[model samples]
Target: MTPTDPFPRVFIGFDPREDVAVNVLTDSMQRHASAPVQIAQIRLSQLRSVYTRPHNPLQSTEFSFSRFLVPWLCGYEGWALFIDADMLCLGDLAELWALRDDRYAVQVVKHQHDCESGTKFQGMPQTPYRRKNWSSVMLFNCGRCKALTPQVVNTASGLELHQFQWLEDGEIGELPPQWNVLVGVQDVPEDARILHYTLGGPWFDDCQTMPRSELWTQARQALNHPLALQASS
Candidate 1:
């Protein structure tokens, strides 16, 4: 499908528990985006009608399964980007938006993530699965991803959706790892485009010491600065 909007559409997964994370992420994206972006929050509260799946124990966030509805939400046309609210955009989002390719159903940073068995933010179980963290950041070619209809997203198992079972191996395109750099878990580079606080971000008291967490702190400070607030007003 052809894009109707000139700007990129970004849908961020928002969990009420991490309100600050989402706000900081949005501010960071706007600060760094070269062009205006259509950003929307995929909060489960607003999607109860479309997403009627029973809660799974392993589900860590409100948008865990709701994120799959990105294609359906776009009316199965054009393209859109979905990202976790816990991320902090460090580079221009236009660069990531430009990487969108219609030839594939979706593009993602395919991380070989094997998180240790334990707990994460809010003491959620740190369950690991195949293609872990892949769904955290996705470039969805909506038209080609017709298989992710609302019905499918509501009923499919966690693995079926996260592992891209609906699409062939070739349909899953790869993005540069830097685009979804895993904080704490990976040796983050100085120029990481997107920082994924997969384990937990500095927002939590316990995660204040996580590597590279100072970046998030700086972003939060910049977001609330008097000058920044005055400029936005």
Candidate 2:
């Protein structure tokens, strides 16, 4: 936690060269978080001895590993939650953090869509290769999971990450579905809080999906609060 109360510092990865994604994330942080949201933007470095691979196949993020490593570099020694920019938070967030337990360095819950429909990853049946929960979001314990980072980095470098073939081991628990609701408009319930654009983004100026837009609105409420954006110093 930064000296500003108990709120964990939040970080996002971006290249200022691309302003739109950075702007989208910056706007979301202020709109959603209960406390001050700290945003960090990292540029690829020429520094030597960088972690080049991933330990867990699931965590091989093209741009996210470096972002995930920032807190550690700053001497932070607690757990950190990493979310996709497309994710929007609804309801109180403390519950997710409180769900952390001793055995797992992370907590994940089965995906609701896959869990209920019996349809599996990519809308297929569950098999040995596919995880019920496709990683839209994740939480990590710096103290407990730090050892896994080097391995994650290694696997990242070992393979062609551009294809996004890596994912973390499934042993970690799933985050509740409430934290990762997708853009299911017209058919979804009224209280759904998050709207993950798992398949398509509403960013297109010509987007015409109302249900998806409603979902985006909900996400913006949590992630794009106008007040929160103005509060950033």
Candidate 3:
């Protein structure tokens, strides 16, 4: 079936205290938008392990939400687009929404970053998914994702919620770039629909080239609200 047949809904993971993320996600759901978007705050407990505790400082809080992606989407009715806060839905999502199929859990390919840090992330490998991990902006089949989350999250070394790189460590099917594209990192073929805030992000990861991003605009607007997170959170 084509994406136009029955558009897929968009779903993004939201950590609490991120009103800016919430605002942008809700705003992206405009009727003129390409498709529907849903936000799910991850809820889970932590399991202690070696790769999780001794080495990874952010371990306790990181992987807890990592494995929840598939489970969260599975709870939904059909196909969905999963992206981080660093993206904006510029074009109609109807095309992406239609990628869900029973055969495989679709996602974009992971390209290695040019920077030393990105390349360095490539060095430490343990999970089955790290072999060719793609960017976080994934368009996937919720049903497929559900079937695979257990295997992905329950690896021998377990999951590592790393902060610096493209891709989550999971065995997901490949979706076309039209579904999820990274602007700065990925070549961003002219026909590509979405723009991933790759190098610099909206909230201030690496602000070298991230200027006038749609997310930044939404972030500014969110801070104007009565209960908003400040710059120094």
Candidate 4:
């Protein structure tokens, strides 16, 4: 399919607290994507039937486990991408879209980050779990991820999905690290494709000085978010 084809879908998590971050990320994607991208923000609060049930012990201030529902959300069709809300796209997503491999159930940047020292935004413990932050960005081969049904996402332990316990490690594929570059932990090359603000984001007052914060500010300005514009001033 063409990069501009309406086939490859993208799903991003949304939290009310980071509302502006989500908007800026979306704007960046739309601006650089070659095709008419189909994007959806997975809002936990709006998913009554799904979120109301107790899923797992894993904690998150944002969409949390809702990300695992991507394959099911897309009706298990073709490939779909899922990214955290606190991310900025600097390159055409179509490049990543073009890398979809039918051989694996899912593909992600294989991160070996050891972020045990810091806490997530608002003081949530940054517990270092297995395959940590790997799922922060993913390309789900929906047809291949048949195990991720609505029931599975609703009941599976956080470890089960995040660690990819369902499939053999061999079933997972790797993408270029540039596709999910962590803000401070990684050396972001001049041509990094995607910048992930894993620690926190400029939306939080203290994160204004973090790596790539300036880029995020520019993206926000491009989107014309009033609060971010005023904050930048």
lDDT of 2 by residue, 49-115 (tens): 6655333444322444554454354454666665555444554455455665545555543564433
Cα lDDT of model 4 by residue, 10-65, tens digit:
99998888899999999999999887678999987677776654644347555778
> TM per model?
0.94, 0.59, 0.58, 0.90
Q: In order, what lDDT does every prediction score?
A: 0.90, 0.48, 0.47, 0.84
Candidate RMSDs in order: 3.4, 8.2, 8.4, 4.6
Worst 10 residues of 1 by lDDT: 224-233
Residue pairs that clash (backbone atoms under 3 angstroms), model 3: 8-97, 34-92, 34-93, 107-175, 110-134, 134-167
Candidate 3 regions off by >4 Å? 1-7, 16-18, 29-39, 43-55, 58-68, 72-77, 109-114, 118-135, 146-172, 186-190, 205-208, 211-233
User: Candidate 1, residues 48-116: lDDT per residue as tens digits?
Assistant: 788899989888898999999999999998889999998999999888888877789999999999877
- Candidate 1 vs candidate 3: the TM-score winner is 1
> In model 4, which regions exceed 4 Å deviation?
2-7, 55-58, 225-233
Better of 2 and 3 by lDDT: 2
- Strongest candidate by lDDT: 1
TM-score of 3: 0.58
Question: What lDDT score goes with residue 50 in model 4?
Answer: 65
Ranking by lDDT: 1, 4, 2, 3
The best candidate by TM-score is: 1
